[model samples]
Target: AKGRSATIFVYGATGAGKTYTMFGQGEREHQGLIFRAIPEVFDAINAYGEADGHLEVKVSFLEIYNEVVRDLLQENGGGGACRVLEDERRGVVKVANLAEAPVRTPDEAQGYLRAGIRARTVEATAANAQSSRAHAVFTLTVEHVKTQSQGN
Candidate 1:
């Protein structure tokens, strides 16, 4: 495909170092997968050097709790329960009413991720005092905009 996206998902059991490995255990020293991966994605895109237009990077964070999708980046924590609609005309699935933020650097992406994480739902159970009840999904959308003047 001339223009498409690349996606990766991270999953694991509770207390299996999923959150710690994905976002690090707080502190800036131990940067996690999201931090390292976002920068690398930009690096690869920069290296490819689009023959035409420019590139834009945007990120979206969401959590699926009890089968309900919630936008973690929305104002006041989350934007409540959202819907996953399939765009038949576009042939793609979209999350309605989700907050997608444009980021130019990995630092900005990290900031967005941290904010979303803070907004995530955490509860205390008999087994684990601190447990995340929702399944988080972080997406990095890279857009390559080619214009007619660029002579594709």
Candidate 2:
């Protein structure tokens, strides 16, 4: 189907290589799933070859800290800037007032990802000094619309 969407959920316990698997060790050539996915998305859109169609891609980063949803891309950590709610109209779970960053390139997407990673909630524990205490969710949305030619 054309207008379909998918989600890749990464979950694991503390120090279980979840972060490493999602976002490699920061090596340029040795990136992770997100880096690979970003380019693939752009490439797929480019391969569409729609002359009269417009495609828009946006990225949003959020984290659930102590069950509180926070927008990670916000300047001041976006604390309490958004809330997870069930949209009865859309019949799906949605985040209200989440900030979205329009990205045109994979680099741009990666940049936002880096910033979000830095804004994650991490705490030092006896087992792991820097343990992520929150669940980070990165969302990429793509919208495509075919434009009508003049007088059509």
Best by TM-score: 2
Query: How much lDDT does candidate 1 score?
Result: 0.84
Model 2 deviation from native, Cα RMSD in Å:
2.0
Q: Point out the worst 10-residue segment of candidate 1 by lDDT.
A: 1-10
lDDT value for model 2: 0.85
Model 2 agreement with the true structure over 55-123: per-residue lDDT tens digits: 999999998888788999999656665867897988999888899999999889999999988888899
User: What TM-score goes with each of the models?
Assistant: 0.84, 0.88
Tell me each candidate's RMSD, in Å, in order: 2.9, 2.0
Output candidate 1 Cα RMSD: 2.9
Q: Candidate 1 — which residues are off by over 4 angstroms?
A: 1-5, 87-92, 148-152
Tell me the whole-model lDDT of each prediction, alpha carbons only. 0.84, 0.85
Candidate 1, position 96, lDDT: 90
Question: For model 1, what is the error of residue 128's alpha carbon versus the real structure, in angstroms, after optimal superposition?
Answer: 2.6
* Clash pairs for candidate 2: none
Task: Give the Cα error of residue 104 in candidate 2, in Å.
Answer: 0.6
**Candidate whose lDDT is highest:** 2
